[model samples]
Target: MMGLILLPQHVLHSVVHAAMGVLVFWCCTVLGRSQYQGLAIPCSPEPSPGATIPAMCVNERYLFLLLTGGFMGYTYSLRYFLHNMNCLSFPSVQQFKYLQFRQTVPKLLKLSCVQSLYLTRNFAAVYFFLGYIPRKWIQSVLNLQMDQHLPPLDTVRGLLDLSLFYQIWLSGVFLLTTWYIVWLLFQIYTTEVSRMDVMDGIRWCSYRGLLWTDLM
Candidate 1:
């Protein structure tokens, strides 16, 4: 009966992870294109007599939107993964007994540690790439002036300075903390159940009961 219940949940988890992987892959591709091809604005040809100048390309804006969307998608997927894992419950004592009681606590702890490292690295990357370096590069490469008065460089700098990165960083941190709490809950659950097993010898009793019931 536990197997019947757990099988579907495990299958659903696999499906969700697979879908997220695909989404991440697609976002990487789009980001690559936006980085290489989209950021370069072509020089406009000189206008003939009375000819109107072509509108400037807004490629940077488009790239910002794409990257923001990607970050949001990845964050949501991570949140869903943690949420589902945390909510899983053993329906009966038999199901709980079958859980790899001794190993579950260690496994959950290891997974939590790994997840924390990954998220920290991701946050650091965002902080460096988006928050610090890109802004500096935009100011330098675009030759932006720090003056309050309107200037062409300042206008260009404003166009390039989409704060999507900071927004995404805040959101990612929120989700990561939420997931961390979920992992903590799983750890607590495992520890409590393991201690209970020591007190009750639940696994051996459950197995013996199952054998006799099956024989009848």
Candidate 2:
């Protein structure tokens, strides 16, 4: 039985990893595009009453909304891979019960929360570490004027700088984190092979315990 299931499991494992890689690449593209245009705008000083807003600053919320959507897409794809593994690892009748157990358990609950938190944290952490902290320290040391009335693009430029360096750095971090997650999931996939053996042991223990109770 293990031999029969092995081939399909390998195929599924490959497919899941491939899909995750594609999603990661897609996410990087979307996020890069969104930030590139906005971050390119230079910090413009106070403008006249009729001055036009920079193109990058306009419709800003829409870009972030798109970025959030792309992030969610990748996250859902990851969840699907986990669910697929559960299905492959158990019989149809037992699968539902196991899934419920996994979902409701505190450890799994913490895992889900951590995964979701990491998704949001990556962007914020990159900005804080590479953009915000360095920029603020430099400005303070140089005694540069902090313009309060600056545009959105200008503010982001001040925070993240107009250089492509931060963008590249952030993208590298994001991609590396994604690759780590894919590798971790693959480890889980391999362990699932022995899941049935553990289940059998559990069943035998329960049966023997019940028999002893009946004999007494």
State TM-scores per candidate: 0.28, 0.29
lDDT of 1 by residue, 36-106 (tens): 23443433343365857533332333334334434444544545545665455543343343354443556
lDDT of each: 0.45, 0.45
- What candidate 1 gets wrong by more than 4 Å, as runs, is 1-162, 196-216
Q: What residue pairs clash in candidate 2, if any at all?
A: none
Candidate 2 similarity to native, TM-score: 0.29
True-structure RMSD for candidate 2: 13.3
- Point to the candidate with the largest TM-score: 2
Tell me the tens digit of each residue's lDDT in model 2 across 1-216: 345335665556545654554455446656557544431233345455686863222322222323333453455444555455334343434344345445435554455445545654464444444444544554566444333444322244533433433433344345444554554455455545554434588898998999999999
